[model samples]
Target: MTRRTVRIAMNGVTGRMGYRQHLVRSLLALREQGGLDLGDGTTLWPEPVLVGRREHALRAIAERHGIEQWSTDLAAVLADPSVEIYFDAQVTSAREEAVRQAIAAGKHIYCEKPTGTTTVGALELARLATAAGVKHGVVQDKLFLPGLLKLRRLVEGGFFGRILSVRGEFGYWVFEGDWQSAQRPSWNYRSEDGGGIAADMFPHWEYVMHELFGPVRTVQALTATHIPQRWDEQGKPYDATADDAAYGIFELEGGIVAQINSSWAVRVDRDELVEFQVDGTQGSAVAGLRKCRAQHRSATPKPVWNPDLPATERFRDQWQEVPDNGDFDNGFKAQWELFLRHVALDEPWRWDLLAGARGVQLAELGLKSSAQGRRLEVPELSL
Candidate 1:
């Protein structure tokens, strides 16, 4: 079997999501598994060069992972002719320019979303990458998730006949630093730093809704900074200008309505940190991060609406747990592997820079909807 090493310049590995999800669980895990087999006996191995501003953190991460390359010089890394792919998990505000540079340097681009703070920036990057003739993709990890995959299977199998609505409940209480430190980074509460629930989560919702149901047609949203002040990493109080909570109702192409609540202030009462309950004409399903439960039309119990007395029926027991019929891999790694193949073998892959731009468009429209206090139509990008 022929094994070819694909050099990747990975920026922002020092950040939380970058370090844990992309670096450790995805890239390193792929390396430990002896790289990805290309089905035709050839294997594509990832050789990552860690790039970040913090020298100490980068060095520590590289050394811990037994990686030979770590550098603070992003310019030097991008200039390297040997680097085939440039992956960014940097802060949202810093992503556009870096990705532009990578595209100009003739490198395949893969990054986390929202691709940029604005739709124009994201679309421009897409155009630049396409004109440069370099492969590009964005991290749409939720679609690969076990629960969502199961939901997709159900949808494909005609379990949900004529899907009607999808309700997503996400987020948990992030403590203010007075007593317990905030679970999220301090910048997440600062709008100036490209932080907010809408910016962070609307991208996920965009792809999820698009991939599962159809493209989003219109959006009506409400956002609020419920906690105006919060303590930072240094135990100093700072004003949180960004919205911590966002309520959105999206209309999909197939007339499917998707309502999602994203918040850092709300306490979780559901089965998981995030759950999507989808109802259709024939059945209903609730999918969390790892598990999915379905109630088919035959099994759905009918109960009379009674206002006076307490209901004795166990409503939750009507649904059956969806079994893990096959081994489920890490969603991040799964997408990473596909991206790697897309770069190495020119494989057919759909989640490209255009898709990323669409995500950014949705986010921008959602924010606009909130500001204008009206439903806004999502227009398709001309480019």
Candidate 2:
């Protein structure tokens, strides 16, 4: 097999998600596995050119990973003729401009979302990539998770006969930077920094609903800044201007209602930090990051509500666990492989910029719905 190398200019490796998921687990993991087999007579190897503002962090990552290239200048990296792909995992406020610059430099785009701070900006990025005729994709990694994959399998196999509703619980208590350091960055709680639960998580929910159930038709939301003040990375107090929690009700096609509550203030009670329970006439399933359990109509327990009696039914034990028939990969890595193939061989890809734009649109409308105190229609987007 012929070996081919594709240079990928990766930005924002200093961030937690970018460092852990994209750089280490995904790309470096692939490198360790001898790159990707293209199913042709060719093996595609990814050569990463780490791009970031911090020279110390970038250099440390490069040296630690045995990477040859690390740059503080994004322009010079983008201008390099050998760099075929541009990957972004930067903050929301900085992503649009950087991505625009990358697209203009004729590189294939693969980045994290919300693709832009606003729907309009996201759409513009999509249009620019389309017009430039570049292979572009967004990181919708949750769709590839083991639990969601099993859920999708059930959906495809008609396990859910006439699906009723979906209830999603996602979040964990992020510590304030006082006694204990905050888990997330301080920017996440600042509106000026493009931070909010609605903007950050609604995009994931949008694609999950759109792909598994149906397209979202309408949305109703209530947003709140539960914590008004939080300490920053330097242990200094700052006003939290963004909404840390969001409760959303989404109406999907085929009369499916999805209610998801996203919060950074709530403590986790579920099996996973994020989980979705889908109900239907035939069966019901609860899926988390790696586990899925289903209770069919035949096996579902019957419970009676009583004022004086203590609960005796083991509701959690009633559901059967979904077995993993095959080996599962890291979701971020899986999508990275697909995107690499799409760029290399023009593989059939669906998770493009437009799909990302739809996610951003949902977030935009969701925030609007909260502000207006009403349900807002999600119109179909184009171009």
Best candidate according to lDDT: 2
Report every candidate's CA lDDT. 0.93, 0.96
Every model's TM-score = 0.99, 0.99
- lDDT by residue (tens digit), candidate 2, 315-376: 89888999998899999999999999998889899999999999999999999999999999
Cα lDDT tens digits, model 1, 145-262, are 9999999989889899999999999999999887898899999999999999999999999999998889999999999999999999999999999999999999999899999999
Q: What is the overall TM-score of model 2 with all chains considered together?
A: 0.99
lDDT of 1 at 109: 97
Error of 2 at 277 (Å): 0.5
Over 4 Å off, model 2: none
TM-score of predicted structure 1 = 0.99
